[model samples]
Target: MQWVLDHLGDISSLGLQHIWLSGVPLVLGLLISIPVGWLATRTRWLRGILITGSGLLYTIPSLALFVLMPLVLGTSILSPLNVVVAMTIYTIALLVRSVVDGLTSVPEEVARSATAMGYTPARRFFGVDLPLAVPVIAAGLRVAAVSSVSMISIASLIGVSQLGDLLVDGFNRDIAGELFAGVLASILLAIAFDVLIRLAEHTLTPWRRVQQGGGT
Candidate 1:
């Protein structure tokens, strides 16, 4: 405990870097995914290709992909930027599927009544489809956020000083404290994000309350 507190400055910086690596990708993934998912729903052929192609990419071993990214891009991904790109691609894959599923889950009458009321296609999506999809889509972000945290731990191998550095340092010295501390911190972070997402889901899904009250 003293060791962690004694090096508190170093630990904080490392922790902050890990957060950046994980968070930047998550935000980027959500933004990129919304449009890609929407487009996927619009085009049947493109839907299959995008989902299958991204799914294949997601299957690649993370370390292998990270190590090879440099060779493919002609520059090493030994930087935060590289980690961002690598982490985001896999997350984007899962999120795109989630977004597509979320949109599809909207009640058909919502779309039909929306159309009958003279809402333009664009209006319906932004005002209706997107709002309705918030809960499930948020559920997807929870998954992606947690997964990205785990992935960012590996980013230390490339050079990002993070809680993962604690793991590596602890491994070399066989100091169980460092390793466990790092792992514990990571679990706390994942849980914290998850709780926040659930809160957001509840706040956004007011219809859930009415449904529970039998359409009060």
Candidate 2:
């Protein structure tokens, strides 16, 4: 505790950096993947392709992905660009399926009712479908965010500033404090992301809240 306290600045800065790197890609991923996922629903063939492709991308070893990245885009991809792209792919790969599933899971009757009410397709999607999908979608994002945080540690191997640096250095020179701080920081940061996402889910998904005695 005292050692952590003494290194508060380092912890906070490193944690914040990790958060920023993890977060931007997640947001960008959702922006792109949600639409892609939704589009996937339009065609059975495309849906299968998206699922298989994303799954394959996810299966690639992170280090190998980073290594190959430099070949495609040259030095830029090897820079911070690679970290963001690698993390974003992971984010998109995980969340796209969930977003698609959530939208598809909405009851057909409810959608028919929305259509009967003269709801525009856009209105039906935003006001009806998206609302119902929030809880499940939130779960996916939570997993992706937490996983992103955990994986950013690997970003260090690809030449990024992440908690993984501490581990690498610690292993190379046998510095226990660096390893301890890095491991501890990673755990705490992961927890913070989980809690924040759950809170967001609760706030956005009021329908999921049940009364203590079953009253509305």
lDDT against the true structure, per candidate, is 0.83, 0.82
Give the TM-score comparing model 1 with the true structure, all chains together.
0.90
Best by lDDT: 1
How high is each candidate's TM-score?
0.90, 0.90
Write model 2 residue lDDT over 109-160, tens digit each, in one string: 9999999999999899889988888878888988898888888888777667
Model 1 Cα RMSD, Å?
A: 2.1
In model 1, state the lDDT of residue 40. 89
The deviation in Å at residue 28 for candidate 2 is 1.1
Mark the regions of model 1 whose C-alpha exceeds 4 Å error after superposition: 71-77, 210-216
CA lDDT for candidate 1:
0.83
Off by over 4 Å in 2: 76-78, 210-216
Q: Write the per-residue lDDT of candidate 1 for residues 42-134, one digit (tens) a residue.
A: 999899887777667788777877777777677756656777788889789779888998998989998999999999999999989988999
**Model 2 Cα shift for residue 88 (angstroms):** 0.4
